[model samples]
Target: MRLKNKTLATWLTFFGGPLGLHRFYLRGFGDLMGWLLPIPTALGLYGIERVQTYGQDDLWSWLLIPMLGFAIAACALMAIIYGLMTPEKWNARFNPGADPEALPGRTNWFTVVGIAVALMVGTAVLMASLAFSFQRYFEYQIEEARKISQ
Candidate 1:
């Protein structure tokens, strides 16, 4: 089956860019890397701030909580993008021809798995950063309380 003239990739890019559907359509290796870019950028930035402001903690701080929320939003956006980019059915009507340029090649199972793993890792990083940020906030709170008693 094939997907031709649908512009699925373009629509996905506009509606769900944070997930990187455009990159995936282009190919593997790089597609997986591109998929992982956004979440870490946002989460790492937010987590760094939490550490700077709060010091440390075990659960999570109010500031860090927003990071988790943003991660969830980002994941949703990515899912939509990925879903839209994928063809619901690769009908024979969309199969590639001998035109060379018309056919970019096929995607193997390994390629799909790689992209999925990359997406998972990105999500994990965002979650961990959110957790650490909260921990930092709690530590700061405890320190502040001790100082007040002294």
Candidate 2:
């Protein structure tokens, strides 16, 4: 029933995306995804705790840490997508009852900033996730090969 501002949506997605705050903003609390988005974020956080407690060498860290990275990256990407949407498209999708040129859907300085932030953060997170997963996997493989060769 209320208007959904593009700037607010973009910022929320960037900041609280893992918790599905943006989804709730646009789609409301009943949105299943809004509730479920935190699962991987929580799991990834637990993975960080595991690494802290058990160290990076722990297999669980290798598996679980990537979940956090991927979740963050995905959220960042979503933020970018939301920020980049055209005013017509944004209004149509999020504020169906409003005018096509509604101010809430209009692009603004804040929206651009949010998009930039999302782009920077998302790319870094994605790269880090890929690097981490590959590095750990190769390290484990090398260890296994060394053990067999011995």
Query: RMSD in angstroms, candidate 1?
Result: 9.2
Estimate the TM-score of every prediction: 0.40, 0.97
- RMSD in angstroms, all models? 9.2, 0.8
Model 1, range 9-68, lDDT digits (tens) per residue? 434433344545545654534666667856644664565576578754424344545554
Q: What is the clash count of model 2?
A: 0
Q: What is the lDDT of residue 56 in candidate 2?
A: 85
Q: Write the per-residue lDDT of candidate 2 for residues 1-150, one digit (tens) a residue.
A: 899999999999999999989989999889999999999999989989998998889888889889989988999999889989999999999999899999999999989999998999999999999999899999999999999999
Per-residue lDDT of 109 in model 2: 95
lDDT of model 1 at residue 25? 56
lDDT (CA) per prediction: 0.49, 0.92
Once model 1 is optimally superposed onto the true structure by TM-score, how far is the C-alpha of residue 66 displaced, in angstroms? 9.2
| Model 2: how far residue 53 lies from native, Å | 0.7
Tell me model 1's lDDT, rounded to 2 decimals: 0.49
Which 10 consecutive residues of model 1 have the lowest summed lDDT? 84-93
Report the C-alpha displacement of residue 46, candidate 1, in angstroms. Answer: 10
